[model samples]
Target: SSEVQMPMQSGRDYSLGEYFVEVKVGTPGQPFWLVADTGSEFTWFNCHHHKARNKTRTRHGHGHGHAHGHSHGHSNPCEGVFCPHKSLSFETVTCGSKKCRVDLSELFSLSFCPKPSDPCLYDISYADGSSAKGFFGTDTITVDPQNRKHGALTNLTIGCSKSMQNGVNFNQDTGGILGLGYGKDSFVDKAGRQYGAKFSYCLVDHLSHRDISSYLTLGPHHPAKLLGEIKRTELILFPPFYGVNVVGISIGGQMLKIPHHVWDFTAQGGTIIDSGTTLTGLRLQAYEPVLEALTKPLTKVVRVPGDDFGTLDFCFKSEGFDESVVPRFAFHFTGGARFEPPVKSYIIDVAPQVKCIGIMPIAGNSGASVIGNIMQQNHLWEFDFSQNHVAFAPSTCT
Candidate 1:
């Protein structure tokens, strides 16, 4: 059964942006327009030939209208310092075959061949059902070598989708995503073999706004800082596509008794741990406690307009107020991995005048929260399918 993305399209809990995600199959010495999304996995890029329909780049019936019903426009390549062109760029494809050698005309990389007959294309699916089709090649991608506990990435697939669905509200400079899934099919798995089955990142904490942060570990570089022992619960772990079971949940140190079936990853729209969404979304029942608890701390604030969903907004104007005096959010996985996000990360403001209820209230209505990057800004996360558990290391987003 297809998982239900009730209320929202993604219905994710937390989201992270500026993620040190890497796409391995990228063209050497190349920079692409990519949006750091936590709502979905499978990082991709724009390919050379794409079929544009309705003045938009969509056809597979997997993206935009069919899957999530959201329209996405073409992405603009980032030309400023913010783009990671030089860092993750490479000289050519490591394919080693003359057949896969250079096509000077194709812009993404120097390894493109002018005339090719290979179906060297990738079909990338988004939570919204819109898909991107592109060519898949190999390249080395890197990140965060500035600090001691650094993060470096290599050998991942990045599709070059010619067209994409609209999600412009979120900075989408690239026409693709830096996928973060599991197993040999994933870039980390491919490059890890040569680079020592490992990668690391200093996850930033959006809450503290601290300089020091957590780490995203792969292989031996996982589960650091005595993150406590495993508390195994029931979680749905899908090796085929890469999805997880919710297992259970906790709030401010209290574990709520929800059905094991509801959290099943197999259940259509059951639950997904996305780092791209800005809020933690749950089904009608799932979102109640989180929303209720969060409301207690708002001593006095501003109320504002909202979308179709009863989206709430609040803000305060105090000289010295404590933002940390509230209930905590802890998502207890079957393996005892308590995915806890800072309240400040959830109690976020979308605009200068509005304070959006971070744990976005959806699912109950007709939308899913595509886990934005806001929730993930401060934690170290690892997609460990080999072990059947994604790892986490706490850190501050610098």
Candidate 2:
């Protein structure tokens, strides 16, 4: 199968904190900046006719009250939304069809349908408390490859959301979510079934300017420059989540004392690589040590008051600090594979002279940790379902 590629944009310039990719959905292909999420299962779009509440609400997507920093002066932000009727190829899914009954049972429940011919409906509530309810449909979507030859995928299932309530991290300009999770209904799973069970993406730094583009590629096209340096690890199959064996962690080449059960999936803990989440979350056992090691060296910078920094635990004045003052951060996976991201990825620049530690603690005792998009930035990650392994290597993402 030929490679299909799309350029990805960072949301910082738009005052949004997530990363986005322009997708051409439906016939004659309408463009939308869909948030690229690997943690979600179903792909969905916003309906044009629905209206968002005309009030300013603070977002807590990153586990804190972090606003978008800019106001969109409009009465109804959903005015010029995606018009589903305009797409000639769009068709609603039947309530009792095989696609709705078995294939998409995770999203479209059979109990929701009263009659066989009724439209299949879906109501999903995310982990962040945001909700979206809508009917299911199928449409043709165009795929853009670098060679200028456009390919169309037909009868692809999607959710045409009638209402979407804002959550902790959703950008107002985001038309929908591009689901790249492990579920059967996801774009990655469906597209991979026909094209190839291999997909890859290179995420640019979260704070990169709009002009600098990252990329998401679908197929066996691994960049020639990074093949030799790429490291491979087994992907622990946990439905809808890509789990990895995170054995240990290191700070400036010194390994920290994180518990074994914290990394054990069969026990009380495990780690998943999630693109939907904005900040990395570690279990309390892992986070305490990481926080101590990272902060123990910074004696020169003054710590900001806890109340002033929102939910972010450690914020310091960036006046006298450079990248050299912080130790290098790396994640050591099973089989000796270590992923060392740039210092800027974790020590994020939130304001003019304020830098905060981007990692957050997992809320509960579930012992799950998330390696969010910020930590994965500037690295080309490839998921090969056929081989049941994921590969990664540092790259410029040019």
Candidate 3:
């Protein structure tokens, strides 16, 4: 198989605050926008429409001038949804199949299956409190459907979600999620294995014009030679996440006094690279020291309450703020790998003449620290599964 590359668009224009790639699934190929999530393990689509019950409704069968209002269990089947029955190549996975018994054992429960030939069902919940209930199915998937010359993959595993909870945080234009996790059944693993067990992506600046697109590339087509000095680091597997080792963080070349346990994998905390999250989130133990060191020189700048910036604790008037004096920030990783991002990546522009800290502490100081998309902007990141390492380099993403 040859390399496959797809254009990615930032969801900021749609108020979604994530990144998405266009995918074509099923027979005759129906195009849908799917969130490119490395943290998710299963690729699924919204196969059913969510209707608001408990709302007022009217009945006209009585033929009299009367209004009947009540909540009832009535729903339109497959209306404006991804109906698997309509697809010519859709096939449900049996409960006894290898895909359901082994590859999907963690998500498919035996209690949900009464017979060996029953449809494999799955119910999964995300960290953001959103949940989906569905069954497993196989279908054809294509990258650029309009141009059939690229070809399509048949009998690929996918989730056919019947209902979704907590629909408020989702992008209305997005029809589903494309799982890029490290599992055997994940899209990345399947697609990457076809070429050279390698995949790469270069995220453009979040504030760039909509016409300027980022890209998700599969296979071994990364032009590392043109991107300047490439840094390689050992890849740590933390199950469904791409973990990286962080020794310390330095601002202006001065390392802060953060505890070692903050980055220790055994301490229930570590660092992972996630493209789904918008901002960088540091553990509480590591957040305080880093924040203090960054603000020491900002004493002369006007400080405002966090509420003004929404979730960000640090905010300052951008009128007299000089970015040159902000100092340089770098992350020291294992194997002497250092990542130095632009100053504007941390000090973000919000409202007019207002700047706030783009990095924040994780809620409740739990879970692993996340290196999100904002910190990774303007750089090409490559995952070499065959070599057991990850590489990165600066790129214009043109």
Q: Judge candidate 1 against the unseen true structure and give its global Cα lDDT, from 0 to 1.
A: 0.45
Task: Please give, for residues 1-398, the per-residue lDDT of candidate 3 as tens digits.
Answer: 57777778777677665677777888867777787877776788878522334334442233122212222434544433576755789888888787788778876434466888888888888766777788888898787544645656677788888777764346434677888878875777668656568888887777776676767877878543335688988888887898888999999999988888888888888899887777788998888887887888788889777687657889988997899888788888999999888888888876788888889888564579998878888788888888888788888776
lDDT of 1 by residue, 88-175 (tens): 4522233334423543112233343444544344344554345554454544554323323333455444444555554422323443
> Among these predicted structures, which one has the highest lDDT?
2
Against the true structure, candidate 1 reaches a TM-score of 0.60
TM-score for all models, in order of appearance: 0.60, 0.87, 0.85
Ranking by lDDT: 2, 3, 1
* Structural RMSD, model 1: 12.1
Ranking by TM-score: 2, 3, 1
Residue-pair clashes, model 3: 0
Clashing pairs in 2: 61-168
